[model samples]
Target: MARVGRYDSRTIDKIYTHVTKKMDDNILDLLDNL
Candidate 1:
């Protein structure tokens, strides 16, 4: 159970980072367009 939890946490962290980066990229694109 601990291992599973650790894996889940890592996966979630990576996903969060990826999402934030994508969001940042999107914002930059919008700013450029504007």
Candidate 2:
């Protein structure tokens, strides 16, 4: 059970990182457009 919980948290961290990176890209694109 502990292993499963650790795996889940790791997965969530990866997803969070991906989402933040995408957001940063979008912000940069918007700034370039202006």
lDDT of 1 by residue, 2-33 (tens): 65564777687888899999999999999999
* Pairs that collide, model 2: none
lDDT of 2 by residue, 1-34 (tens): 3655647776888888999999999999999999
Candidate 2 regions with alpha-carbon error over 4 angstroms: 1-7
Each prediction's number of clashing residue pairs: 0, 0
In TM-score terms, which candidate is top?
Answer: 2
TM-score of each: 0.70, 0.72
Cα-based RMSD of candidate 2: 4.0
Residue pair clashes in candidate 1: none
